[model samples]
Target: MKKKKYNTLWLSFLGVTAIPVLAIFIITMVVARNEFYEMRAIYGPNFIPATRESILMILIFVAGLILVANSLWMIWMKGMVIKPLRDIEAAAKRIAKGDLEFTIVTQRTDEIGELCRDFEEMRRQLKASQDARIYTEQQQKMFISNICHDLKTPITSIQGYVEGIMDGVATTPEMHSKYLKTIHNKANEMNLLINELTMYNKLDMDHVPYDFKEVNLKKYIDDCAEDLEDELATRGVNFGYRYNCADDVTVKVDPVQFSKVIHNLIGNSVKYMDKEDKRIDLRVKDYGNSVMLEIEDNGMGISEKDLPRICDRFYRGDSSRGKTKGSGIGLSIVKKIVGDHGGQISATSKVGLGTTMHVILKKSAGGKNG
Candidate 1:
């Protein structure tokens, strides 16, 4: 190939041209010693003889040719190396300027070539990570804007209704009662926001001690579901379960927090169901000594792109905003509880199909799997 030939030529030029020129200079000096001495003896009386000048001119011309050839060879060698380096540098500059699409294609399989490959790979990874981070930040900002607008609308209405009542504009008992209930509802919404914020702050603290105990997980999940069944039924949501674990299947965790995890997941499933017979199913099974709980829902399922980040604090799928209800902290709290209990939680969903959340709780206390 042309590339192989070019590489071979550069290496040959470096070794043959540059190195031999150096050797010639040494050889010429030794060979011309007697000639120089003879010239010196013949010309010293005249000090600047014509014959000595001609001999010196010839030696100077030969030395100049050697110097020029060596210089050319070094320049050629540098071109092979420096060209790729400059290309890498330019690509890096483009990346710094916010272009993530650049790639380096160097032919030589040398250290510089390896360096270029690594540089390109690193740029690709950094761009992917940065793009994801920017998207997340934008989503967070939008959510905050939406939350602010949502909260402000109800609060403003409540304030106006209360003012009207105080100003004696509420003429009937029914009107007064409706206004009071509206105020109470808005106040409850504000309280819910405050509680969510408080819980989020607690979770953000890097290390919060969790008091974990060995829990009869099967019994616990059944109890939690039973407690929430009436609430779900009132909202036209049906709940079912398939418990395949032994009667004594257990896991080490804080019972209250573990209950909260199950509670939040089930609540969201019931709240967001889109089908006529809105349903959520919880299945528990034993994997060796560990326990696995899966919650499936026939709801407006999350998109694949958004599923990965659902557990992030304050993150809610944009599509779910109008259809679902919560402070966006429920899943985040569940993730923290599972993490503290030294377990793993993951979710899979299709846009129109449904969602399945898998929580794996280990039996041993000292080791955790992610």
Candidate 2:
């Protein structure tokens, strides 16, 4: 109890007030008889020293006790309560004044110390929140600026072509049709940017609405490949799909979001296709407790520096093969969706050769869910 932080104040009170009082009392009793005669001489021969001496002793003892108590109270109040409160007050003022450049220090192990520590923790958290808010605001501004920069080019091109048609600059029927097609393409590009922005904002979270359901992996991917083959063929790109997994291989995934992930991956491959003999191959395999999906493309591969950051939101590379690499959020969406579904996505690429994207999803319990 004596070693406790709160109990020490009680001990200090006893030492300064009650213990000193007991000592003062004992000394007065010891000297009472001797002081009686001295009191008689001082008061006068007829004076009643017996009663009056007792009064004087009581008065002196009471006065000394009051004086000691007042001194102790002043000392304790200044050191224990007042000084700490003042320091905390100063800290509050500094924090209120928008300054977070200092630290709080205290050596006492009492309630004051705990209060100081808590206050410091609050300040530290507040500083961190403030810093994070500032960074987020900066990133938001950059995002808006990037969107504006990208939108300006297409918007200007569309305007110029429309003006050309109106100004009769596209006089021939062929020129008019070409101008109309270019304008339509530019408008589509703008719409794609808007869609990417909307999707990115939705996926930039930990708890996206993932409706997980068990599905045979091969059959699901086969359907996806079937849908994409016709589209790729229209663009003169060959598409292939392979499965080395068991017929009963199954995994839990959100059907809608997973389809987007597949399309986005292939979309990137098609976007970077630089060779006339464009080709894309997708394969799936069972790997113990996880299933691996790979998409390889004969496209202009990402450079060493850009490969690492390719999936980062709004990151654009130096490759000029694709007219514009898009709004730069497709692969980020892929990663986000994959991670939300308790999976992983990665890529490997070499410039001028090709690239392979790997996605691994945890196999469902009872892998052969037949």
Candidate 3:
């Protein structure tokens, strides 16, 4: 039952209005009492006049009524302002008590309304941050689960083979050679996985520098084509390379990493050639300030869905060729190298058609000079 605080100006108005009525009532009573006394004196009648006590009594009655009426009016005016503030206070308390479900009912166009909007926005941001944290934690758990499964199989195979050799179970020379080969192969797989993990960690660091230089686009293309031509011919695949760029169409990039990129794309194409007429096409074009290179193949192309994630580290799609090569980090490394050179790379594929990778690199101001 807290008392309501009335506006000071409204209370003052009530006081001012009461003053005039009180003064008039007092003055009228005094004047009427005097006139009655004067009439009695002048007429010489025995009738008694109203005295001072009667005037006082009339004045008191009139002043009390005026005060009461003014008080009720002031109470009504104060209620208009108090109710909205009380509702806002209650809502705030509920929010403090962990009930953010309450909706504010403020139509005020003042500081209070602005404060309410800010509070709502802050709550929304906090909720989003909480959701993101939960999602990240779930992803971390899944990554660990997948890593365990991936590591356990290879280590178990290596252990089994090594133990058989140690127990003298491999009697013949061929059997011993076979066991040793199994052990060696498993060890190599483990080493490769560890290397991939290590390299990713290093790349995540802030200061790992890459070697960048101006590379002759045509010469590099020719070198890769020459090296892979014999291998492709042996596998009955026709590999065509065209370097339409100028002989000096140079771009600033890491040569070693770029070589790895070419090696991986060509190697993967040859590995997954399922058709009788397998073909791979490589081409480079000079577009003044930039150079674009494309590698396209008619092998077992990836699905439309997997094209988005093919460049992600360790993301092996269902369309993967037989388990014949590296730890599926080739495309990811290619993407990272391209990105380091301030370039862009993308892939397009159809289920039955083929896959094409396009890379664009900006030529640096440091032109190629021998």
Candidate 4:
């Protein structure tokens, strides 16, 4: 559409400029013809005008033609070239001044129009990059604030416990032992926070090493669930597993990192248990070329708004913040580990019911469970 408009402008310019030149040419031709006829009648058939007069007339005619043409050419250039160039120059100046909102509007079909289009595209890209940078900086600030706040709680607890022991407040052996254990637990919590931060940085940098192997999916999940049995029991959470696959369904994955994924998810579920009947179900189901592993819990579920961002780094849901002790990067680490294994993870939850985490992994090429 813009090209067509500019093409029409060019045609209009040519037509307007040609009309005056055509008129001048026609008037000159008519006057010259009339002068010749008059000369023939007054000075007989073979007569010609005096050389001086002829030269003067010819010079005047040529001068008038040149003057009219030059004026028309200047007008055409001003409208077609100078004005559009000035507009582009001004738009560039505005962009350099950080005014990205300015748009270069043009109806040119030539090189100038293309230049404007390219400039607009560049401006849009610059604005987008600026916005992304701003968002990242804000997120970084928030992450630091959250981490400091998280660390402070544990550090404060450890300090108080140590101070109590030093002041002889824990006089009894049992009291001393309890205070020491409490201090140890607070230190452990701080260590966990630091570990999460380190792991997140590794994941971001793609530096987390993996040792991939083919393992039976059913056995892997069963083992992982069994390992968590004692922990679940300690929290009064009933844990169960069901394998809906044939004997030898297998997938290639990094065992240690994959274990982390399982532990993080199960731990998250345990941390958020709000019901008396706390239960977690780990299930492995076989599809034709892939397996679906699920860890579902009857704990407090995520809100719809927070569910989408659960796997985002440093994103702690409002409900999860006061309810659990975490740096909010566990799910992000889990997500990254799963993604690195060429699998995908997702969560579905209702606020009051529970949250179900689903991991889908492609079956090993040699593993057939038929």
Question: Candidate 4: lDDT over CA atoms?
Answer: 0.84
Q: lDDT (CA) for every model shown?
A: 0.78, 0.84, 0.73, 0.84
Model 4 agreement with the true structure over 56-78: per-residue lDDT tens digits: 57656776776677668768877
Candidate 1 structure lDDT: 0.78
Residue 82 CA displacement from its true place in model 1, Å = 1.8
**Residue 347, candidate 3: how far off, in angstroms?**
1.4
Q: Is candidate 2 or candidate 3 better by TM-score?
A: 2
Looking at model 4, the pairs that clash are none
Cα-based TM-score, every candidate: 0.78, 0.64, 0.61, 0.76
* lDDT score for residue 34 of model 4: 84
TM-score ranking from best to worst? 1, 4, 2, 3
In Å, residue 188's CA in model 3 sits off its true spot by 1.8
Which ten contiguous residues of candidate 4 have the minimum total lDDT? Answer: 1-10
How accurate locally is residue 288 in candidate 1, as Cα lDDT from 0 to 100? 67
- TM-score for model 2? 0.64
**What does the lDDT come to for candidate 2?**
0.84
Q: How many Å off is the CA of 192 in candidate 3?
A: 1.8
TM-score of 1: 0.78
Worst 10 residues of 1 by lDDT: 361-370
lDDT string for model 3 (241-336, tens) is 888776776777778767777777777677656678899998887766888888889977888778897887656666662354445566777777
Better of 1 and 4 by lDDT: 4
